[model samples]
Target: MTAVEPRTPADPATTTELAPAAAPWWTTAVVYQVYPRSFADSDGDGIGDLGGVRAKLDHLAELGVDAIWLSPVYPSPQHDNGYDIRDYQDIDPVFGSLEEFDALLAEAHERGIKIVMDLVVNHTSDEHPWFVESRSSTDNPKRDWYWWRQPGAAGAEPNGWGSAFSGPAWTLDETTGEYYLHLFAKQQPDLNWENPEVRQAVYSMMNWWLDRGVDGFRMDVINFIAKQLDLVSGPAAASDEGSPMGAQIHDYLQEMHREVFAGRTGAHLTVGEMPGVSIDDAVLFTDAARAEVDMIFQFEHVSLDQGVHKFDPLPRNLVALKRSLARWQEGLAETGWNSLYLNNHDQPRLVSRFGNDTEFRYESATLWALVLHLHRGTPYIYQGEEIGMTNVRFEGIEDYRDIESLNHYREAVEQFDQSPASVLAGVHAMGRDNARTPMQWDASAHAGFTTGTPWIAANPNFPEINVAADRAAERSVFRFYQQLIALRHDDPVVALGDFELLEPEHEKLYAFTRTLDDRVLLVLANASDTPLTLQGEWVPDDISGAELLLGNYAGDGAAALRPWEARLYRL
Candidate 1:
């Protein structure tokens, strides 16, 4: 298939703008991420449930998003929220019944919103029946369903690989006298995709969801499923772990497509989350003809702030950021596509990590989003991101939830020789719990997220910076997001325009241009707290008849960018 390159203008002096794409809805789609546990509580329960999300479908539809990418709501032990699945086919009671899910699908679709369910097939809950039967005895037929290895010569772990949460990835199964691998928490055991039975089981579950009217899947660690080789040592310090770049992962994905989705007639999207994936690898993963996944969530940009430590603070490298994104843009321009997001449920809030959350909080959050939506890809807006939501502020480690943070606290201090106080501060700054705070809807007690105590506390600043307040204000983040979403729907430049990074050496400014035919859209963002004079062709005098399309402040191409300001223009 030929790549769809943007049409060039016939003349350099006057560019003609192209109309919006009329096919392939996702090419310019905006996806809203709903962390069901914190979105809302319909039953007055402390925990947010499916009914809670159902009540808020109108809010999503009004936001102008094309789809909602819900986090996992499958039955689990709640060890890692719902990522550890005890049952793939049933809904957990807290999230309402399967009938309620059907209702949500109907309601969202009624409002023209597609539902992309989170698929956590990389691992299964240890409490799951398959894992239980596998652990019952070494001779059990299901024993090979999960990775089980005999102790090494010294009775050590199967290998030196480490769990993402920390420590060895293997846990001793005393009953079976073997070690089982878990890339995440011990409660979440890695499935052996090398086993054909496991492959069929996962594919069957996927078809079940599709038959239930689900739109697509946001596959959790899907690329890591094919660990076709034996577990082995990692780096000097880390333990053995599974990576998506495993040689046979391609074959597994292809086989899965042939078995599960080849005959599908509709736009059922699939996005794989690959943390360390390269652009070359991503090309194959998302190639239109390859029939694997539609796109992938790459972690290079998010990891830029961390050193070896996830909590360690490092200044954002603007030049590196530009190159990282540009490479993905160029590499996939022909064969694949991109999934754009600055923050998600597992990362720190966008405004808190990359924007100024103090005086210029509104400008910075809006600016960060300005850059995100302009990229040539499917954009994801995480829950609470639309209204400039900042990260949480918990006074003590005891107040923090999520095993990822809790485990880090223990291991970082004991094994990593880090100070307890410093680690606590780091967790406060960069922990996943920061993004998991309950959504701030109104100024009522607990942000009106629940009638009773909330599963997590709402941000204390909710009164001044929440949906109710933003919706009421003349100029608010919520309104800005709506405008951006509308622009993508109305202009083909946003969905299929060619991307060009401008001023690659600028320190405080991130500027880029998008072109489709004679029309061009220029985006200038001040990523810092200080002002920067706009330059290059984007300066008002250089481009004729440029009109400001979106901006955080009342400004133009001729005006100086205020602190943390972002502006978009069309010429």
Candidate 2:
């Protein structure tokens, strides 16, 4: 294959290029996220790979998700679970060869399913050739590719910025005698986006991937691409949530658009993972007319359940969640789009976090599905979320593989001097490993993920929660998700309707309305295990002749909603 030539920087003279006329298919599509290392393991290497993902494409197609977002499959040191990319162009040997990746891409495209890659340009593995060269000598031509700086007074670090993995953000390179900035792990140095050379290289790599057959990208910590030029120290905090999303980010994104994505013509999808973004920031970031990013994964909704510590299980205020969702809806109603999600590789399983993981597991899973998919956004389903997967209670930290979780445990117990039991409890409650458990395909040894041991333990409840069991059951959570995906495609109101949340003050019931072209759809859900009194804005008489499009339990009255029940009524 011919290499993609580097394109010249975009001239400000022709910057006001308008987006395409019609909305693209992603506007209504539901994306399924595949954490490749945990999704499957065909090679018996105890880790999942591209060949494993290829074998499961049928499952995604059957589940009805229009696209699949496969998290970082590039060559990496497996530090931070493949996010520390060593090579931007080739498939990891652990995953498969580039030939196998090409086959997977071809097969997915042939099945009408778009493949979205996890683009990790914020940093690269210290072992990457560029990083190695940069650290080799201060006089190296590529030394400026990364953020290398001088030590502070008294041989102190460059800045007080903290690492996301619980350490100083800057690491001193002994060979160069200069510190390099790393927003996350020390092994993953932050790229200097200020360099025009760096920007050209990144844009060229993106074009190379696009020139190949992938459909889109889920950019990792994209907002952190451009940090404050001064590199000022921020307030000291235990956890480094990375850099703040600043105003300069827009300029960088616009430059990226003009160079890498300008002429794509709405054919590809882009979702920026903006950690510090508020509703106001998201408006400008995801606004279609701006051509910055097609959508963004916001952190506010997911962080609502956490207090100062992620493990402290604070009672999630239902009203606050409703209000927050409403705020984003109103903020992005005019020009921007929203990407709705409940679970992901970095987050704990939704059933355990937000829903009843025990008695009302299936019902709560179905309930949350309706609430999110019915909203005015493209819904994303994490792997095993369709089967009502729950969190695991691993007794020791040695069993966990996440860098963030392990670092937090060490910091809490060793540095901050917190109780081991309390920190362990926190890991049990909020560790990312909770969602990274091997996919439970059947009630077999190792959950049929592999005949060999899995890299991580499969959830012990696989006997009850496996996909094979759901497939045979009369009504399963998987089936409900399928219906939700189908609804987005079959019903226009589900995709483009105006959203109105009802009963924001209700503690146990989540209700909302979606209106489009005189077609009104009411989505009502009982969020708890026990039945709750149904009294709110919508009375039983409000829509006397509404058609019941879908529901989990049988009941017809405004007086009471059964436990774990939800219904979609079209009036």
Candidate 3:
């Protein structure tokens, strides 16, 4: 593959006054994620709504994020927390009416913040009208819209594939005497993308949203849209390595682009949430020439610390993490793009999972922010992450609200014969509920997230880690994030530089450089609690005259880095 040249600063007079339309806005923009159910609640309903998000637009605007990626707010039964959509074009009553959503979108655009809706097309709620019609009878016209397979001998599941949440992937529809496929929970029945009508319906829905003024879409489990129809059994060890979806994913993506996005005009950002995607696959998925998508959210870095199952986690190793991230930076350098993130709605808090959340919480949070924002990708900041929110330590299964966590607990303790305490420990460490806890707004009760009871319990540490406290402090994690966002905007190298990893084998320190022509930005981070001196080989020759752009600790030029300390230098 030929390399795309790095974008360099040009003379103002020589360049056009307006940016070329061919260049997508997301290439240099930062996106902030808001899990609506936890961001803020209005009407004292103990649940967040579009009104709540509208009320909090100022907070996002002040954060300097270019766009806001909202988790699903579509109509649903609240099964799978709105990911199981019953309606594509309407807002759920639990959230708000379409009028409220319109107001929110209008208000967000007024503040110069782009709104990116979560596009969940891999499946729809089993109660969806389409699915309802499909299951009404064997001869229903919409029956082929979803995967409906007859059971094998002894009325067993059609295949041996397991649901991501738990149990067999196929659920029997008593009315039709056939099993329908659901990769996730049974509430979310997989859509049959092989059916041209199903693909057209999805594209039509997308066009409706784009017509409604949504800036772009964050496609959910998009790669899973295409599945093998052979109904073959998967590996007993539980892996999706050779899933049939891989065979026709690109074709479907290209078709989607042509049908829904081909002639669309705007700074639209399209990102596919792809799991088990390789670097080579990502390049094809995101290459401009392919016209598939603007970018993709890859899982390589996040999967490094996982054990047998996602709930089971291994110890964090900075060397492995650095190598994983650097590989992506290099892989997507010329032909593709990367979506940089440490945590999202379905992942644990970054501070708790990968950094120190206790003694050096502030340092670790700020250091990690630098590492991610300085990378050559669009950085996505999850809600509450800017203020250093730590993972929740729910005492029992009852305290958790996520279906995935609940299902894991039941299966681990009942079928696997694992102790409740053991499963609870893993759930506390890696459960999605950790990231779903209400956003910490202030030190007030419920972290000022709601006046009524919260849908899920707030983290006990909210009082100390809330936004109000961070704003009042002289130096805080929120402020560090603000600085990083500013740096990315004011500095071109952050968005367009070529990346080179330094000391790839170093376990205690993560060092890298981003260069665009003569401008060089060197980032050195101490990934451990103990202080250590910078290794000579890791030091660049131009460091002596480089200006200190930012640092967690006060220093003019420090040879030794403090615990979890990080410094950014511009040469």
Cα RMSD for candidates in order: 5.5, 7.1, 4.5
Candidates sorted on TM-score, descending = 3, 1, 2
Tens-digit lDDT track of model 3 for 318-395: 889999999999999989999999999999999998899999998999999999999998899999999899999977
Model 3 TM = 0.95
Model 2 stretches astray by more than 4 angstroms: 1-21, 232-242, 555-558
lDDT of 3 at 123: 96
Query: Which parts of model 3 are misplaced by more than 4 Å?
Result: 1-23, 231-244
Give lDDT tens digits, candidate 1, residues 270-361: 88998788899999999878888889999988888887678886877888888788878888887789999988899999998888898888
Q: Whole-model lDDT for model 1 versus the true structure?
A: 0.84
Clash-forming residue pairs, model 3 = none
lDDT of each: 0.84, 0.83, 0.86
How many backbone collisions does model 2 have?
A: 0
Who wins the lDDT comparison? 3
Instruction: Check candidate 2 and list the clashing pairs.
Output: none
Which 10 residues in a row give candidate 1 its minimum summed lDDT? 7-16
Error of 1 at 540 (Å): 7.0
